[model samples]
Target: MDRLTAFVSGAVQGVGFRWWTRSQALELGLAGSATNRADGRVEVVAEGPRPALEDLLARLGEQPSARARPGRVDAVVDLWTPARGVQGFRSR
Candidate 1:
């Protein structure tokens, strides 16, 4: 499995980005969370099969209504083993 962390910049917050992200991630069977940063960016961390994770990232890049305007996505691939279970994706 591949773990990914993406930082999205632009008009992402207050635009249902987190909700959309969670929904899409669930559809792709990814486990992670998205949170708004104080720097006006949204940070998303997801872990799953490589292909599925990529698909999730693609979906996030094009969320139709909540997609960031003039957005920038920075992604990194790593390995993560959650000490405990992550229930569901959430906005925090």
Candidate 2:
């Protein structure tokens, strides 16, 4: 598996972005959480397979947030071993 981090920007806050992300991640069988940064950006850390991760990015790019804008991300995806099994996706 792999872990991916995405820093989503623009219209990403206060529009149910985190809730949407949590749902999407869970649907994609990803493990992690999404949260709003103090600077009004959204942060996501998801762990899943490569293809699925790519798919998630594609989907996110296709569907921009309604409240905040999504900007370029400083993302890193690498081999990830889950220490504790994830129960569900959440917004933090």
Candidate 3:
């Protein structure tokens, strides 16, 4: 198990970014949340396998498939750590 906390920036709020993130996380069998921050960034936190978390991070950065990503993603800064075991994925 692993934990990934990704800070997504650039045109990410009020555009279903969190919703898109929740879908991706749930598809990868991850448990976490995507939240809109006050500093014009979206914070994505997921707990699961490292591979899955990495995939999620890539997707957040809009790699492999730009059409799948919501809004315009300029960058995604992420951090990996031990999993804290979340319940389910959500958009908040």
Candidate 4:
């Protein structure tokens, strides 16, 4: 398993971004949390197979579509770490 922590910037607050992240993470069978930080960025931490985590990263930067991303996303910066047995995805 891999642990990825991504910091997302732009119009992310109060736009259901965390909820959307939770849904995507759950769909990919990942365990972690999407947290809103005081600096107005959403911090997404996910632990799962590397492939699934990669997919989630891709989803986080998805283009506008039928089900577009929750808000206007300007950038996403992430770091990878060893997984520590996260249990379930949650929107914090």
Candidate 5:
């Protein structure tokens, strides 16, 4: 399993980014959460197979919605390891 925490900036907040993330994560069978930060960014934490996580990251890099364009994605770590206790994908 792999865990990833990414901070995404740009027109993220209020543009359905969280929902889009949740949907994609679920489709990839990833467990995690996507939340809107007060500083105008979206924080996404996902745990799953490395390949699935990578695919999710790629999806997140795309436009979340017609009105939302992602500017940057800052992954906290380049490598991933198993993270215990994550259940299901969610928007928070």
Candidate 6:
């Protein structure tokens, strides 16, 4: 399994980013949580197959929702090591 933490910026908050992420992650069978950060960024941490993680990142960059417009979505991803098991994808 592979783990990744993605920090998504731009017009993310209040635009259903977290919900979109949760739906996509669940579809990919990834385990993680997508949360809104106090700094106006959305934080997504996921664990699953490397290919699935890569696919999730691609979907995020491609604007998974109609609410995410061009030049309004960006993400920074980093390899992560989870301290505990993530049961399922969630929105926070």
lDDT winner among the candidates? 4
Off by over 4 Å in 1: 63-87
Candidate 6 per-residue lDDT, tens place, 1-92, comes to 87889998888899777887888898899999999999998889999988898888888787544534333576665656643567878899
Candidates in order have lDDT scores of 0.70, 0.68, 0.88, 0.91, 0.75, 0.80
In model 5, the worst 10-residue window by lDDT is: 69-78
Q: Root-mean-square deviation of each candidate, in angstroms?
A: 4.3, 4.6, 1.4, 1.1, 3.7, 3.0
Report the CA-based lDDT of candidate 5 relative to the real structure: 0.75
List, residue by residue over 36-75, the lDDT tens digit for candidate 2.
Answer: 8998778777877877877676656664334243443333
At residue 84, give the lDDT of candidate 3.
Answer: 88
Candidates sorted on lDDT, descending:
4, 3, 6, 5, 1, 2
Error of 6 at 28 (Å): 0.4
TM-score of 2: 0.73
State candidate 6's TM-score: 0.82
- The better-scoring model by TM-score among 1 and 6 is 6
**Which is the winner by lDDT between candidate 1 and candidate 2?**
1
Candidate 3 lDDT, 3-46, residue by residue in tens: 99999999999988899899988999999999999999999999
Question: All candidates' TM-scores?
Answer: 0.72, 0.73, 0.93, 0.94, 0.79, 0.82
> Sort by TM-score, best first: what order?
4, 3, 6, 5, 2, 1
* Total clashing pairs in model 1: 0
Best by TM-score: 4
In angstroms, the error of model 1 at 84 is: 9.0
Q: Any residue pairs clashing in model 3, and if so which?
A: none
**Deviation in Å, model 2, residue 8 alpha carbon:** 0.4
Q: Which stretches of candidate 5 lie over 4 Å from their true place?
A: 63-81
Instruction: List ranges where model 2 is wrong by over 4 Å.
Output: 63-87
Name the candidate, 2 or 6, with the larger TM-score value: 6
